[model samples]
Target chain A: MKDIWKKFDETEPSHSSIHHLMAVYHLHKKNGYARGIDIANYLNITRGSVSITLTKLRDKNYLTEDENKFYHLTEQGQQLVNSALSKRHIVKRFFSEVLQLPAEVAELDACKIEHLLSNETGEKLICFMGYYLSEKPEVLNFRLGFRQFKYQCQSVAECRLCESDCFFSGKEISKTG
Target chain B: MKDIWKKFDETEPSHSSIHHLMAVYHLHKKNGYARGIDIANYLNITRGSVSITLTKLRDKNYLTEDENKFYHLTEQGQQLVNSALSKRHIVKRFFSEVLQLPAEVAELDACKIEHLLSNETGEKLICFMGYYLSEKPEVLNFRLGFRQFKYQCQSVAECRLCESDCFFSGKEISKTG
Candidate 1:
């Protein structure tokens, strides 16, 4: 079957909205209230931009504002945050466990992919991964070779470790030196 | 624990680049090759924009192009795609299983979350979810109840026919409704 990612590619979302939602979710989780300045500092963005987004989120009932410059997730807002958190976990696993990407790249890619999948397919993937991890631990090990490669002294050793049981056996690992 | 989403409230990725990547990924998956026009049609974007993005991806070694208007993922490009796909699965599961979001919202949120989490956190989450799903299925069910409520559902029964125990009581079901 065609991967679900291919199907949902047509309806990609705005990255700003996703970013705003994540910021709100994290802030609320850290402390019951989050300020625009704190969010800006954490994300390395301008306070002006954060203020604008906070205002928008408040207007949308995703946030409640207080006199102390703090914002909290409303019930509606909490629901959105919860969903966002779930997506964050899934994306992270896919990168680190399934495709065996480097930590930095996997983390970034997970953030992007979390916004692109459909509910049905996403659930199936989770189920599949769960089953695969339980039933086929070797797959997980093979997929996670990318992360392991970084700690290895030689790239070929990393490739050999992976190739011993990897599905993509024919592909040769070219030496860097 | 501090949720991770709070770290990106004002940050936004380069929209054109992300959109272009999505378009190319979609087209390549569909036809095993993609041209500017194919990407344009799939993404509802201009052919000129597709051409520009394709040139950029080619230069970056994410794509290989030829006279037949076809392009394929280079080794580097394949790595990126594989990584993205893995992360997508992780994000999807977190929303659907851990957060117990409805299929629709979980999928949508997963798409957004996939791009935001750090690899360390993502891996930790995977380990947590894996253990949580297997060891304490009941607590997870209760969490699912919360998710159902968040989506405005009256109760878990409203979403599905209970065959096992009720989430609230952990008692076996007697009827369909």
Candidate 2:
């Protein structure tokens, strides 16, 4: 879908750009500021590349650089980083909970999804699923099982139950029933 | 972190390639077979690009193409497509539920995340979150609030608990609590 591509495009950080952003975020989070060489070393990238990225980020008002080679996120930069982090968590939850994907995959996927999702859609989805789980705990188990099987390569038919007892078990029913 | 890049690099699909694959999947799902022109037309991309991507996919044994342009996904290809679809749903749910992101953003984010995540991480995140939600619903609510404040352009200290309670409470909690 065009929409899908658009989403992908929005989140498709130039590999280098994302690398730089992450390095800075990490360094800043741990230390008060980050030096270019330190970031380059951590990222296993060239110092020249880190310098260029830092220059770009500074120009974009996302970073503040000093003579000491140390850099810090500007207010705007912090906002962006926070947003990215939140989106990443959301993506992780989505893969883990709804799709029942494995932890490694979910984390990887969240990195990509966090960049792509529009604010509106992401919020709505979280709200809806959270509400569903709270009100219908029983359905949550069923859905989790279904999602797990689906992730593990089970066919829909294979996951379906044939016996009445299966449906009538102690599991609580929800509106979807 | 290096491992993360390795997975991302390995799974990264060229834009044209993914478009071609999605077109093929859509056409096959709708009509049981996909033609070259049909894919080209649907994607609004050059036939040459489509042809090139198709050739690559063929080389990878993801599809079977005949001289007449008729094509179908190989079992491997079908499996991949199914995985993509499942990821799409997870992404959607994640934005809606955990992040409380808007629908548009969530959908967009999910699309991006689906492509980036490693299968293992994706599955693990889902399983853990599912268990957490079932075992500790309050934690889910806390996470929801935390994410909302963290990502919604508001500082955690700035969030109004009364407002959140009003918004998250009630009988239709399943709808969008």
Candidate 3:
């Protein structure tokens, strides 16, 4: 558990890099071509940083540019964006539909982690959400009971949910984020 | 959705930095004082790099050093770790307990996103898990039924679980990550 976070650096097409790839995706979809300035505008990043990132992407074999400076995703780049969007889809549905959180919260949270979640987790989440949302009698009963139920953790020691720290009382600290 | 990934920069106590703080936290718990070398060893980072990160942390006012160079978390630093740990706890339980993913996968996935999730999602997940875990007949029935359920997607167009790309069939791309 203590070491898992380190693997984040090993992930391909990291959260920001995926978006850099995705900017190409969305821009190509919107206008059929993506330039460095166009990607910079799309991501709201400065041209200098975007060029550095794009150069890294190109050097890594994820994308390519034509003589006209028109950028395009290679097969690898397209797959990264596709996989990220798929992960985002399931994550958003789980947060919004099964948990019944607001749509905005779900979208924001999913967007933040689209590329970070592992493929196995993404696959399982898709399966779990599909199973949970089925219109079976048990699913219906559980949903109704869940809405009427309230969760109250009396103490950090007794609370299985917060075995580490008490977020319930961390109102002051949460404000810092 | 395109803009949300950029906000990751706005988040303080970033994923790797949180571990720097956590190294201080665990070292303090284990040794009553954290030195520059202690944190570097704890995080597997080189002393030169850890010094740079620790100095930045001090500059940001999240931690401090004393005459002996022992490290300590300020009130704000402690809160950040507390919140991140709390978030990690709930996320782990959600994946391992409620979603019933493998424990190793859950732990890995949760660690990857511990410092990235919003406060709202963390709180809601805790409440939802509490409600879902309650010992009610509806809950039991649903749990039994969910394990028996299977999720099958015929195509991307027909699958609500996969809105953007077909992860179900993307066996080739998943290995890239």
Candidate 4:
């Protein structure tokens, strides 16, 4: 299956556009609808900036402004946000559940990554996280290992605590180094 | 650990800037050096655009351009590229080895994700892949399941092919849906 669009070179969604889309989607979820000022306030951007991007989104057929001036995503826009939302869910879960990152860190990391990962990569990652969380019993050990990892991974020459069997061991690196 | 930078609302590297940084790093790796016109040719961008971004990278202390017009990443730039390169290695391995995605697809996906994933998530993912690849024999079946998942995940409704065992099944979603 060749996927030229997967490169997303020319057709890539802008960061701000995707950000605004998610903001609009969440606002709709909370208030049952969204508008320009609502999105601006939610995203902490100026209303004029929101209006400009929303107009672009509308021109691209991703959204429509109703008679009441409430914003609604078109079907295409809904699909876009749904995919992003699902990916964000998986990434956030992976960080929080498997890596033991704090929820806020997980959310921030997932938000940054949701736009960048390919669907295949996202699926595989979610699948792996599902298996890991369900099967693994050493959550505490893993969290401690992360602390150790943070300290020990700084240099190939300076690692002192990793076991000989550890994949990231300085001894292992020295053999190749 | 409060990571304010992860939000990347400000002070985030632009996509073009990251691309240029990687290009310069790769050029240095393969040819022992990099130059502006070489990067422009390699990335298929205009020399003017390359010059503009290279200046930004220099200002950020990620790289330096000599009087001879060759570009060299500083220590900080080298560290940045090394981290991104390692993450790309792990993501590509997971996609190709674990998920059975084609090598090209994996590479492209890895490139896109290399910039976005937090280091902590990358470390956990690499550890999981190491364990899964070394321990699991159901890898083939898992790949087939992914094919099925690809077909079945297009809609939240009418997803009956997934077994009840599947965490992503409609039944699972309906519990919350």
Candidate 5:
């Protein structure tokens, strides 16, 4: 584990690099092209700072500039973004489906977690979610159910019809049981 | 999501700091006290390098030195280590109990994951595991069952009597189904 962290520290790009990659992704998604200024503006940093980072990224072969002077992610960059996004999806599913967090909260948490979770744990999460959902598809439904239940119920005791049906009820019982 | 990553970058300590905290933790656990040489030997780094990082940790107030020159983690340091270790526990449980990975692999993965997982995702994983386990205690049983079954069965097709009773059989069918 110590060696793994050290290797990650040595090889993995900094948070700013990830931020740049994501900024490029979001900028491209928004405007169909990512410009250096667009990345800077999106990140709330200076254009010169973005340019420096972009230059480093290009030197590292993670980005390229076209004839139109628009920034684009290379295959390596795309893979890095895709891998991070994949981890986010697994974590978001765990949050929304398994823990029944709100969609927005799940999305936000996933973004934070994607960078932090190891590849092994990320793959395990994907497998576990697949296995758990196969066994209990209702867990996937818990997101919508939780929202509706939260809106309807003033308190747990008030939901008389939801005694056995409510997802959170089981959790409450488990705490005491 | 972007803001969260930026915030973590600004506030979170470097990887070396985390490594030092972990070294101190392990040394204290193994020897009842941590010293500079112990940290250096444990990390396979020079005592000078250890001193530099430890000085930074001390400046950051993560460690304290006693009159006997033994090192100890401060409350804040203990909290940080505990939090990271807690994340490891959740990931390890998911790998071993949910995905049925080997114990050593799970441990290694957990150690790697502990550093990567966000607090939000860590908390959610804890809740998800609790909820999932409460709903299906068989997942816990599957851990032990898998070890025994792994020793007995040569391959998936070789398990005759273990068809429906096998833990991973359902997972395999689910994958193809």
Candidate 6:
């Protein structure tokens, strides 16, 4: 746990860089071309920042810019985006479908961690979702019971999750800060 | 989705910064006090760097330093740490208990996203686990069926999760780069 946060930086395309690449993919799909300005507009960032990150992405061989200045994700870039997108879907579905969180919170939470999740974990999560959401009898019964069951975790002393904080009573983080 | 990635930066504690505070909390609990040097030693980072971050944390009102230069978390700091730890536990349990992932993998994945998950999502997830893991007959039957269900997702086209990448076939990101 001490240095696991550093592993966050080990992902090939960083969060910002991956989003830049995704801009290229989505813009290309919708408009048939993507340029620096298009990406900046897509991501709602300054064009200068987009240019700087795109140059690094090109140097790393994840994307390419044609002589006409239109950008596109390379096979490697596409793979990374694809991996992230799949992970996003899995986590989003888990939050919204299984946990009954709102669709918007689920999507944003998924986006925050999509590029960080390992391939194995992503695969395993989807498999779990698949089984839990399947048409099997036991799965159906479980989903119904789970939906109707009420949890009664009371005080911190009696709670199994009081090692650091209790989710039920921790003050909400001021997101504006 | 355009700027949702930026929401990652909106968390009160950056991933590295949160761990620095947690180190102080752990060292104090284990040894009854903490100092900049102690945090540096615990995190295996340079002391000068730790001092810089500690100053920033103090300015942000998350921690304090005493006469002998011992460090302590303010009430605000403890709440943030608690929230992050609870989120970490919920995710770790989901990965290991529900998804049946390996312990080490599950822990690392949880660490990677602990501070980033929204508090609402964390609470909802734990409640879901509470019901799913309960001794109710439906839950037990579902667990047994799920443990034995072998998923066979063959390719991207027929898969429900092929919006971008196929987890089963995506190239493992080279963490070394």
Show where candidate 4 strays beyond 4 Å: A1-11, A126-177, B1-11, B135-177
lDDT top scorer = 6
Alpha-carbon shift of residue A165 in model 3 (angstroms): 2.9
For every model shown, what is its TM-score relative to the native structure? 0.46, 0.64, 0.88, 0.72, 0.69, 0.91
Q: Choose 2 or 5, whichever is better by TM-score.
A: 5
Q: Per-residue CA lDDT of candidate 2, range A80-130, in tens? A: 665556556655665555555657656766664454455445445444455
- Model 1 earns a TM-score of 0.46
Residue-pair clash count for candidate 4: 0
The 10-residue segment with the lowest total lDDT in model 6 chain B:
B168-177
Off by over 4 Å in 2: A1-3, A12-16, A89-106, A121-177, B1-6, B12-16, B93-106, B117-177
Winner on lDDT between 2 and 4 is: 4
Question: DockQ: which candidate is best?
Answer: 3
lDDT of 1 by residue, B1-177 (tens): 133333344233333444456566667666776777887777676888788877887787777787886877777666555444444555566656654556666665555444344434444444334333443444344334333322222344542321112122122211111
Q: Is candidate 1 or candidate 6 better by TM-score?
A: 6
- In candidate 3, list every pair of residues with a backbone clash: none
Docking class of 3: medium
Q: After superposition, how far is residue A155 of candidate 6 from its true place, in Å?
A: 3.1
In terms of TM-score, the best-performing candidate is: 6
Model 1, residue B127: what's the lDDT?
Answer: 38
Q: What is chain B's TM-score across the candidates, in the order shown?
A: 0.61, 0.67, 0.88, 0.71, 0.68, 0.89
Stretches of candidate 6 exceeding 4 Å from the true structure:
A161-177, B155-157, B161-177
**What's the DockQ for every one of the candidates?**
0.08, 0.23, 0.51, 0.22, 0.11, 0.48
lDDT of 1 by residue, A1-177 (tens): 223333343442334655665676676667765788878876767999888877887787777888887777777666554454454465566556654556665556555555454434444444334433543344344334323332221332453222122222233221110
Ranking by TM-score: 6, 3, 4, 5, 2, 1
If both were scored by DockQ, which would come out higher, candidate 2 or candidate 5? 2
Worst 10 residues of 4 chain B by lDDT: B168-177
